[model samples]
Target: MRETNLDNGVLILSEKIPGVRSAAIGIWIRQGAAHETNADTGASHLLEHMVFKGTRTRSALEIADSLETLGGSLDAYTSREHTSYQARVLDEHIPVALDVLSDLVLSPSLRDSDLSLEREVVLEEIAQVEDTPDDLVFEIHSERLWNGHPYGRSILGTKLSVEGMKGERLRELHSESYVGENLVIAAAGNVEHEEFVDCVASYMDTVVPGVRSEQVAEPSNALAGLELVDRKTAQTHIVFGAEAPPHSSEDRYALILISSVLGGGMSSRLFQKVREDLGLCYSVFTFQSFYRSAGMVGVYIATRPATATRASEAVRGELERIAEQGLSDVDLDRIKQQVKGQVMLSLESTGARLHRLASFALHDEPFQGLDDVLSGIDAVTCEDTLRVAAQYYDPGRHLELRLGPS
Candidate 1:
């Protein structure tokens, strides 16, 4: 991996992989839903859609065709922390990918009519979550857990906020946070570092060198221990757990290991016991959401309303068992290998590498190579896992958020 900066302070990171035919280039802007004021709640996401509508030099159709003609895909997504615009194509098409990506970020034409249509599309997106119990469960979990902190704000924003977003507000969002200081451009695959840097530097003129600031507030885990929402659905969607360490915390590694043991796969405690043994739910998994100064942990499950309480009890029982009994050395070693295997396997994809390249940089942390990551996991003793479990896995401490009929 190689890193450098354009004159305008836009950081560019790249890795050249031999024996590969594909490459992924992405532009990451540090601004996201968390950075917006109440009025501009969903503007970051809306702007992500608007940029694809057209640019100063290309219409939406042209932008759409720009990569499809090369048998590539250009896409973007807005998250709680940042927005990413990415392109994936064969090695020979890196230049085309770079050109289209640069145009989207540097020259978006946020037209009023485009915003009007995009608003409805975004509104539907917001509505779609209600219909998706799995998604709606977590959405409500965050809303209740964080209690109005930026972290709780939905990436899709509310109906009133989306409707209130003006073209000018979007323009302000782009012009302000999408500058060089808040941008990290990264690529991976069969591409040279110096050449990629040169191509990126050419955009220096329009890339603002000015600094952009963010006001980050870490929220207290104020949601009640249990809250059940009534919705007319077949099954009850549940999310349980509470606050955990951030990306920078050393406990971060232990948290990852603990979550995997809880619900990482078919062999995981939650899956084996909840589905295979009790025949409770079809989907059961653990999740960890990390941010700059805060993070969250939740285990999600869905089951028939009649068995929802049973499934939830099974989940809490598992947590309590692990926290009290502690993981054996054998269990600890197995989880480490499981995590290491997943990491090594994921390296085969250039898109995954692109995400790592930008993510660490955006979080203001040094990149952890495969060896470093594996070693970190290896160093996690059984005591470490037990410590984290004892700290965070108490049933009385975490939140139990249920969505669907009582």
Candidate 2:
């Protein structure tokens, strides 16, 4: 892998895979929902959609066909911390991929007519989430857990906010973001580092240098408690979550191990005890999220209303056991191997490597080859899990969220 930061501040990263004929590349802007003000709540996300509407040189229909004609694909998405525009194509089409990606970032035509049409599409997206109990459960939990912090805001802004958005604000957001310092261009596949860098320079040399708006100050108003939302649904959706260490913390490895032991797979304790032993729910899993200043870990479960209380209690029991006893040496070693396997297996695809490369750069993490990552996982000891579990996993510290028919 080779990394370069152009004079304009756009960081370009590329890796060559010897045996593959395909490549994955993307332009990542370090701006998203958290970067927005209340007045322009969904500008970042809305802009993500509008970029595909058209660019100065290409019509919407032409943009759609640009890569598809090459048998490749173009896509983009917005998250809480960042937005990405990406493409996957054969190595020979690398220039086409770069051209389309750079164009979307540099020259979006955010016309009022386009905004009007796309805003409704975004509203429909918001509605879909509200209607899905499981997805809605987490949205409610994040807003409640983080309270008034910017991180708590939904990626899909409310109807009122989206409707109020103007094309002017979106244009300002595009100019404010999508600049050199806030951008990271990355690619992985059968390509040479120098040649890929040259391709990127051709398209992105005109991009201006801009400042990065990273917030390192931790949230002081984080909340935790039981909150219930009444919704008419067949199955109760529950989300139990607690504050966690940020991305830079060494404790992150320990937390991952704890999550895996509890609910990472069918062989996990939650699956064996909750589903197999008690037959409480059809699905149960633990997930982890890390940000620059704040992070969270959660357990999601969907069960019939009659059995909701039992499932909640069962989950709580597992949390208690983990917090108190931590993990045995055998359990720790097994989970470590499990996590290592997952990390090693995912790198076989160019697309996965593309994301890994981009994420490490965005977060200011030093690049870790497979050995470094495997070693990090291997170095975690049983005692380390005990410390993190006790510090972050007190059942009382969690927000107990429930949504379903009453």
Candidate 1 colliding pairs: none
Q: State which candidate has the highest TM-score.
A: 2
What lDDT score goes with residue 354 in model 1?
A: 88
Q: Summarize candidate 1's per-residue lDDT along 1-406 as a digit string, tens digits.
A: 8999777878899988788999999999888888887777888999999999999999999999999999999999999889999999998898888999999998999999999998999999999986888898888998788877888888999889998888998998888888988889999999999888888887655776767557477776456499999999999999996877778888888889888999999999999999999999999999998899788887999999999999999999998998786688899889988999998899889999889878789888998888998999888888887888887776776889999897
The lDDT, on a scale of 0 to 1, for candidate 1 is 0.88
**Superposition error at 332 for model 1 (Å):** 0.5
Per-residue CA lDDT of model 2 for 1-406, tens digit only, reads: 8998889999999989889999999999999888887767778899999999999999999989999999999989998889999999999999988988888999989999999999999999999998888899998898889878888888888889999999998998889888998999999999788999999999888888978767645878777778888999999999999989888888899999999999999999999999999999999999999988778987999999999999999999999999999999999989998999999889999999999999888788899888988888888888888888987876778998999988
Q: Per-candidate TM vs. native?
A: 0.98, 0.98
Candidate that scores best on lDDT? 2
What is the RMSD of candidate 1? Answer: 1.2
